[model samples]
Target: VGTLTFKDAPSMVTEFAAVMKKMASYKHSIGTGDTNATDETRVVDGKIYLIINPVNYYDIVARLTIQNANGVFVTNMPFISPDHIIQSVDVPVNKLIVFIENGYDATQSQPEKISEYKETFAMKRATLYAIDMLGNGKPVDNYAAQVYDIAIPTSGGSGE
Candidate 1:
């Protein structure tokens, strides 16, 4: 997990851009079979998992809206059970918005909003973000999530 923290949005963006550039360089080297390429970014099964909290109020669900180069993509994040907590998202996410909803009886019906959080900073393509919604803003545990760089195996196998 990264220990860096930003005091403002601009600084965050700048740091992310720099990190992205470095990651791109590493990806290029890896693509050309450079054995000495830094293991900063690793793709496991061509996907990365976002571990979301499974504990929420009854009848409430978490929804995610992701924006990338292709366009805006929306989906109901499955935080209902332990098996459904970890969501597998495709690479190169530009922005992510998460919100809690309740009281939606139909497909097209509007639900009552509980809370929302938007992250405009870019997320690395092949990294893990473990979200701990319940642990945020407490003296003991204060982080909403932590990013982890995946480790690539030496045996040419996905380290599942």
Candidate 2:
């Protein structure tokens, strides 16, 4: 994990908008071997990289997405298991990282939003973030009752 210094919220928001415009032409990839695969972790002239480590409780599978503050969808990673990490490269700064409770049925009408974090990431830094659920025992149907937290790993910390 890299050390990150928080930028002023107002300035960061402006910068994020500009960066998003610049990134309009860039594409993102999922796994290796895709023709359109773009290495997000590669040091770009004006972008940041993020690695999200989601810690699940009660052996639940988490569905996560990244969205801008205006609720615009950026990207999503479905079915992230416990302790699994997802890397997003050249991401726009000051976006919201959201986690939704998994609804096994593919045809389910709506998925519930359990937790979210609005972050202003440091430029040129590959930052590691951990999202964790807080509660004891198994979860019930009302996922909104559950609490979640997002944090940066400390020095030498694995965020386990």
Candidate 3:
């Protein structure tokens, strides 16, 4: 993992955009063990990468996305002012990450793919509220709600 720091807006945008593009796409590679991310040899790691950038860094709140082999993407978070700290929250496999911008606002809630990662194959169609999302970012349920995502990537995307 690498971090790019910039004082100017254009520099930030360009660098950030590039980083995001790299993360959201997939590639083919080969390794013998838990380290190999190129092929569909491992079921432990979801073969996908999601990259998201704060548009202009104007403000960032509520981030959401699927998960994969490399890492997780921004799902929900507050408007990212220079003051706010952006950190990587851990996510277990078979789950996605979702963070709402204003944690304080009850009405200003975000969306979570209810089906979540229930379907990892491309042929699997999506149904809203299919899975649920857990606010605490836990792989399991929260209270009576049991949060999740509306859609998830299918196994076809992995070139499987």
Q: What is the TM-score of each predicted model, taking all chains together?
A: 0.21, 0.18, 0.23
Off by over 4 Å in 2: 1-5, 26-49, 52-160
Q: Total clashes, candidate 2?
A: 1
The alpha-carbon RMSD values of the candidates against the true structure, listed in the order shown, are 24.2, 22.5, 21.6
lDDT score of residue 71 within candidate 1? 90
**How far out, in Å, is residue 52 in model 2?**
7.4
lDDT of each: 0.31, 0.32, 0.33
lDDT of 3 by residue, 40-74 (tens): 22121122222123331222222222355679643
Better of 2 and 3 by TM-score: 3
Candidate topping TM-score: 3
What range of 10 consecutive residues in model 3 has the weakest lDDT sum?
139-148
Clashing residue pairs for model 1? none
lDDT head-to-head 1 vs 2, winner: 2
- Candidate 1 structure quality by residue, lDDT tens digits, 1-160: 3322222345545644443333222222334456775434432221212332222211112122346587965433221222333433432222221111221122423444344334445344444344433322221111222343322112333435
Ordered list by TM-score, greatest first: 3, 1, 2
